[model samples]
Target: KSFLSKIESYNITGKQWVGSESWITQAELASDERKNILQGAIGFALPQASIPGLREFLLSLKPSDEPQSDVIKAFWEKFFDCSFSPSNTSTMCNGTEDLRTVSSDYTDVTYFRAENNVYKAVYLVAYALHALLQCRNGSNPITGKSCVTRNEVRPDLVLEYIKYVNFTTQNGAKVFFDENGDSVAQYDLVNWQMKEDGSVEIVNIGQYDTSVPEGEKFKLKENTEIVWGGNSIQVPRSVCREPCPPGSRKAINKRKPVCCFDCFECPEGTISNQTSPECFVCPPEFWPNEKKDQCFPKPTEYLSYKEIMGALLTGFGCVGIFLSLLTSIIFLTHKETPIVKANNSELSFLLLFSLKLCFLCSLTFIGRPSEWSCMLRHTAFGITFVLCISCVLGKTIVVLMAFRATLPGSNVMKWFGPAQQRLSVLTFTLIQVVICIFWLTINPPFPKMNMKYYKEKIILECALGSAVGFWAVLGYIGLLAFLCFILAFLARKLPDSFNEAKLITFSMLIFCAVWITFIPAYVSSPGKFTVAVEIFAILASSFGLLACIFFPKCYIIIFRPEQNSKKHLMGKIPP
Candidate 1:
């Protein structure tokens, strides 16, 4: 006992490795700094040590025999020997927290995730930690001193201990909380202010219990109780009418707090920004009036070449096709293109519908998108696409037929003629019509209701019919395009401009390229991009057709008077 007592005094009297014992002249006590450190360490360790499955730890030391080796030996010994030295090694247990449904016993409750709000999480953490701090204190076995976690709102009590809060900013006082049950911190954080209904969340701050048993990191749940006020304030969410996005004024009762304060508007000419933020505005060269917030094109170079010309060309083009078909029928004993009179009858139907295709393409420029106008536009675009491709296919078959007829015993002659051309056009058209019918039967293009749309009165709309229609349309177009490609390749060595066939082949190739590129471009964008896509499509494809089929007509009709013959429209074929 005497021999052991000699070393025990040395352990207490500053002979220990950490030098913490230096001021302990008395056998029973430690200095204030040492006491403070021990108090803090005790604050941390005592809670863990008392955990039912946790093994206890103790400080250990390494001893040396030589006096010269004391400094070197103490350095190595402290590094190696300083540890809790748990007694149990073999037994292992895992602890997982179990959450019980919080009782609605108290009035203090934040709204749950009905709206994806997180205010409840902050308060729950505050309440839980409140209970935990109380559950700790003198209840602990390690700290002999008495401590208390009361209901009092001390700086350290409710707010400071919270994990998600930003205590530094005035508005940051109690702005954030972990709403979901899962908080990485040992204690969850939250904000509670008297004035706020829901919490405005503070983000990017840290938590105390963020580490796991394995020392891995845990994610903080997204639902955190956040409040608005004090050092930091959040911008109030703005809800505005579309089209009248950022600049244009709402005519009558602007749906808002007051005079255009929360009115749904866009600047006169700008469109809504493509990526983020939900608002309305007109883009450059676009204008809207205060009375209706109707988006209209602003006068610019686009005026002569764009919206006006587009509307005029489209309107006149359909009319011209209808008129030409009428005139052709009048000349051919009251009906049909010459191809229909002979074995080439199928080509007549192709020609007729090709005229229809041009007419339909013109209808796309009817007016700004509304329920009725939008439907008309889609109908026009749909018919135009289907018929245009089918006509190209019909032309290709006719060219192939001309070559096949010269070869003896070739049944390709029987496979196609005027009747076959008629059959192909009628069949392809019926397929297209069926696609339209299916679309109309299912979810036909209609006005899509949006709560955030223009003044909540006008519905933002796009074609929302059967996906099958889109697929069918693309398939029909693609098949014809492939056939056109094959025809072009077959006719590669043929003399240019011998007949209109070369012009038709080149036109078909251009049309195929335009529609093929359109597939992905349309699919990748939102419905709002429909008008933009269609405008570009019409200009590209329609122009290709016009250049191939009508440029010579225009040149002759305008410049060469002798070439303009009434017999061109009224020529009677051999009876």
Candidate 2:
């Protein structure tokens, strides 16, 4: 009581105070002024049990009762402040508060009973005496003769017997002391709850029994509500720092306790939980959320017709197809014109058809890649380009052969006539068809999810199952294009009224330049930009071939009809 009063004087009552068993007992007896300071404190006390007939024995006490000691009579007079005798009934203690009536000082009957340890000590001594004086047959166990008298009993002998005492009480409680002469540890968790009348009540909230196994020793009652310090119902925070939340880790402070730390957020692409000390890296197919608390599946990406780039490429492909068809229409309308008939008009029509196929093949590369589309995009690109190059090669050879036919006894025209031109185109295009077949049969292109390109998204692209097969297909197309460029370059100086070889040479130059630059650009492009680069290359090269080869013929046929006559074609009207 004096220590608590000193703590309260220091204004330190806000903190919880854990006290011994005597602390609560004195708090119950102390005045309200001295006890109210401990209203929200918690303490441990010896567990109390009901003593049989104890309440009735305390209530029946009287000063005039027979066989009452002088101590009992004197204590009764001091308690009631009056004397009592059987002879003088008028002066006897009456109308006064007794043990039967509840008062401010006496609340419950169990508190008045002897402490549990006292009963266990008395039983220990009784059991020890029983063993010490017990006789076996006609001799005592201690003396090995007649039963030993009380005079022969020694304090050391009694102490030795008390060390081994083990017995159970009538209340079914086991009583035994350890080697250190201390009983098993057991205590009741008590909380000092303040009532509305400004009185403190010690509530038994839980128990701690050392006799039980480890981890099972401390237990709280389910129905009891603990009263925290400052009469607050909520538990108070006692640590120096709060715990770190999810999506963050703890950084311990320098020269400080473990509880004191700072919270740092997890890095990108990783996540952390509330209890984990380190961040976890998300899997390749997953990405961390904004808060870094969890992982989610990554978004898939592909070149789609809905995006701006894909739409613009699609539109350009359509324009290329329209221009090719327009050129074809002009040639068909002016089929017998001198300019159309001068150049091999049959190969011109075939070349325009192949250019149209080249434009249409680029559309297949725009949508989400699939098994069939992946196979079709590369194969169609290779074969259509081969066909288109073969047509240009045929035209170049025809220009050279026409000039050779005019020479003295030159039979080149018959050897490389229209039949042979068609056979050459068929042979060159068929080689590409065979290569495509072998590529598909051996190791075809297939769709795959590319995860390494980006951390937060999946790139849906075509995987070249066999790098050798993909490169071979591209190499064959390059070979045909190079051959056409070489042939057209040699025949570019051939004399003719409408020299188509010069136009073929210029078109092949543009084709070679575009594809040559496309190699490095295609290899270096990333994500969906790779597909866009290939599409741009296709459109640029196809436009180059179409504009250089056919736009001049269409212009002269439509706007310069007089220059398209047979006299101009035979070079008679050129001067």
Candidate 3:
């Protein structure tokens, strides 16, 4: 009833039948026509008689010669005609030949001899004979008669024979026991395969030899040899649910076995990489691929000069260089003019050179990062810009002191003369150079591969080893520009005929604006774009300085030559 209930639950509808008494003849058993009726169902019978008929009946249901169908057929064939029994008609024991012959008188009943009956009875008789021989004596010494004494017939003698019984059976089975008197467990792995005649036959796929080591015990043939149950080609599933594959983990079901569980995706930065119960983190310098099943080398990334953003920034740097060169030439050609001479042309020249250096330095930010380039690029940029701003500062101070000295009997002009202008420029530049030296000596920048910011790519960038040193460089330059801007603003209306302070103020304004906007953008930008933004700021500020201060002066020197002369601007001093 329980079997019927289970089959019904599984929707396995089939005809049901029963077997006769155990002692029934083959003809009597075959009398029931229902025994031959094939169906997808279960059967319950002893391993001795029913196996052969059951095998044939099940095979009749499967007309097709599929590998799995053959496997099912082989299972029954192996079960009925097993090597474990001594009465098996086959002339083989395991894989070895059986040479011993059975007596002809018992030939008809010999076929019914199972291992549980005939083989065990043979061992029992052999042990009894051994014990009897050991106990037998011609006569007892004290009794003086031919008799077997009870002292001679001992349990130890029989036990010794049974424990050490190592012999080959008539069926050619080499049987023995271990130290614990337990038989060696061995099993044959069988598979069903289709014969050439369109019939099913049994195949010895492999074996489990317990006498071998544990790892070498179970040996199965190639996967192609084994045909699983049912008509399907895949291996039969025993668990309640399918397994959790790679890149995922299992969530155990409280109501079922551990084999029955739900699968879940692994967490970020980790992977299972195979069917596993838990996930683990990938190694350093490696990242999970798209499937999260395995780790791979992280892809390197940087602002390459070949990319559009990099090319645009580089082109702008080139343009700045061209303009700076042109400006330097224009000033040098009109070096004797009063307007150019009065504005400290030497300082102007150095400032323009520094601007050129700034433009070129920005190019370093747009290429594959190297150790030397990373260290040199930022330090060089900071020092050069400081020099540029220093020149602007010197000019502002000279303009302020020159006008103040002309108004009264002041000796400020001598103190703030051309020589002092050169000294101040040198002193300011040397201070920046010293700061850069200290910064490099202490904790300098170096090339770094960063993986934390992005998941898929490695940002190949320059790491500022010390944040304080970096900010200090920027802060010092900012201070100098602020001072220059303030001084120039105060002296913007001071004798405009010979004053360059108005132009200096506007240039400083542009420079300050560029840097102020750069901070937030640099902070917000991700990956290589951050480098691009910094380069853009550098070019923008350098161009502002060049255009604001020099462009107007060049316009007047080249286009309006009369305005460049001293007589046109006789306002206060002896021009």
Candidate 4:
């Protein structure tokens, strides 16, 4: 009655329930209290000690109206004293039943009274006694008497039985002992769930076996089997920081655990590839791939005969070769004709042969770059073009001397004879040979991978070792062509019946134009396209020499038989 009196007078104030430093307020606390009380009333009702605290907590709500009073009365009616004594001192409600009284039957089992450890201990003692009884009858050799002493028991026999002890107890638990006498420990992972009425139940979620390897020892059910705290169903974490993502390396804090680290980006030419502890440099032959997290072998590039640009350049080079061959055949077939003979037929033959070699030299540039190809391609091209230009210079001098020898007092032809013509051609061609020999001996072209021109591909190409040497070879050829162009331009109006000065001038004009345009195109192009541009310039200039100089002569030799005679070619028309 005194406990009930304290509950009836107790009151709750907002200040008493207000939270000082958290989200929980007085209203939330009161609501939780009511929820616990209502849940308890529906299930098992409040225990004896909790009843007074619950009653006072409800009174603290301060109900003033009849509706509030009726609500409180209904809540109070749900809670009645249901405890029963063996003397029948308490009343038993219709819905209330004790778990012990509702069962059909109960059986006694050894597991309920004694745990598994007790069975293990009993088995250990029994094995020792059995071994003692068997070995107790054996007498010591020194005594020569029936020995019933406890010290006479064989320790080896006792230890042997204990190592292999295996049996099932009356409780159905299997008992076994290891050689070391240590019991293996295994445990069930439990999930504790709190009920709305402030009661807890442990759920067997999984198990851990010490006999298995460490990594495989613990196993759990699905995540849904465990209940998490607060409102989230996710597994809670207690990490110092989030894990670093890929393409970044972790800077571990030596003072903290491995999980705590700072993330930093991988440096250039290096990659982390994963959430790694450190970054590694890529191999020299490899470059960072598109994602920048991995290294891939760099693409090998060259002017290949199989590719589009290479095939096209090869076809053009073949065409130039065919044209030069056909022109040489026309000149050879008409070697006796005045037009062919008048141009110093031997020099013309040498020029056509050199032009054919020049066309074929461009073929070397259309294949994979190698040390041999790099050295041969440039040197062959330089030597062959010099030979062709020297022949042209020789023809220009012959034409000039022939026109001068026609004068009444001139003996220029006798001084600059065919021997002099051959000597001059050889001298001009030898100068280029010496230059190329020095160029190859000093700094020569070689195959190199051009990495900067294009990032995605490695340009497998010939790198000219000496810029000065390369330009010197080209400048010497240009100077000879310019001198021939000027001399031929001066003798363009010569009255010879088969003058070739005009044709030489026009061919040089086309040759200079092609090479001048080639410089900028070669400089601006990239990768395989640079090789393509060079091949195009070679074919263009070679074709210019072949077509402009010989196409007219080929037409005259094939169709104009009357013009081929020495009488008609010597400035004397048929009468």
Number of the top-ranking candidate, with TM-score as the measure: 2
Q: List the residue pairs that clash in candidate 3.
A: none
* Each model's lDDT: 0.46, 0.83, 0.71, 0.69
Query: Candidate 1, 292: how far from true, in Å?
Result: 19
Question: In the order shown, what is each candidate's alpha-carbon RMSD?
Answer: 27.9, 6.4, 12.7, 13.6
Cα lDDT tens digits for candidate 1, 120-190: 34444565465445435456222232444455446544443454332221112122345653433342222
What is the lDDT for 401 in model 1? 70
- Cα lDDT of model 4 by residue, 1-575, tens digit: 34323433462211111112121211222233233221211011111111113233433432233434665334322343342223265454333332223222121121111234554566676855554454334652323445445665566756655655566544434456556776454545544344665454444466555556789877775663565444234565657787666667789889988888898887777777655557787776787765568889888989898988788888888888888888888887778777888778888888999999998999999888999999999888888988888888888888898889989999989988889988988998899888988999999999998888765568898998887778888888888989999999999998756678999999999988988888899989988888888888888888888888888888778887768777776778852
Candidate 1, after superposition: displacement of residue 35 in Å?
Answer: 66
Among all windows of ten consecutive residues in candidate 4, which has the lowest summed lDDT? 40-49
lDDT of 2 by residue, 1-575 (tens): 56657766876655666777776644454445544456667877887665556568767765446444887666565566566665453345553447665443333566532466677778889888776777788676765757656788877777777766788777655777787887777778888877766567778898888777999899999978898877778888888888777788789989898889988999889888766767889888999889888889999999999999999999999999999999999999999987888888899999999999999999999999999999999999989999999998999888888888899988889999889999999999999899899989999999999998898999999998888887887888888888888988998877667788889889989999998999999999998999999999999999999999999889899999888998888888973
| lDDT ranking, high to low | 2, 3, 4, 1
Runs off by more than 4 Å, candidate 2: 1-13, 18-39, 43-53, 63-71, 82-190, 193-199, 203-227, 231-233, 251-254
Candidate topping lDDT: 2
Misplaced by over 4 Å in model 4 are 1-187, 192-201, 208-272, 275-284, 288-293
lDDT of 3 by residue, 1-575 (tens): 35434544565422332222232212222212222221211222111211123334433433133435655344433533433335556422342211122223222232332333355446655854453454235743333445445566666655655655666544444456788878655544444333334344334456666667879977766764554443234555456787778888889989888777899988877788555558888877788877778988888999998888888888999999999999999999889998788788898999999999999899888899898998898888988998899899998998899889878678888888889888888888888888888889999999998888998779999998888888888888998999999999999998757568999999999999999999999889988989988998899999999998999889889888878877655464353
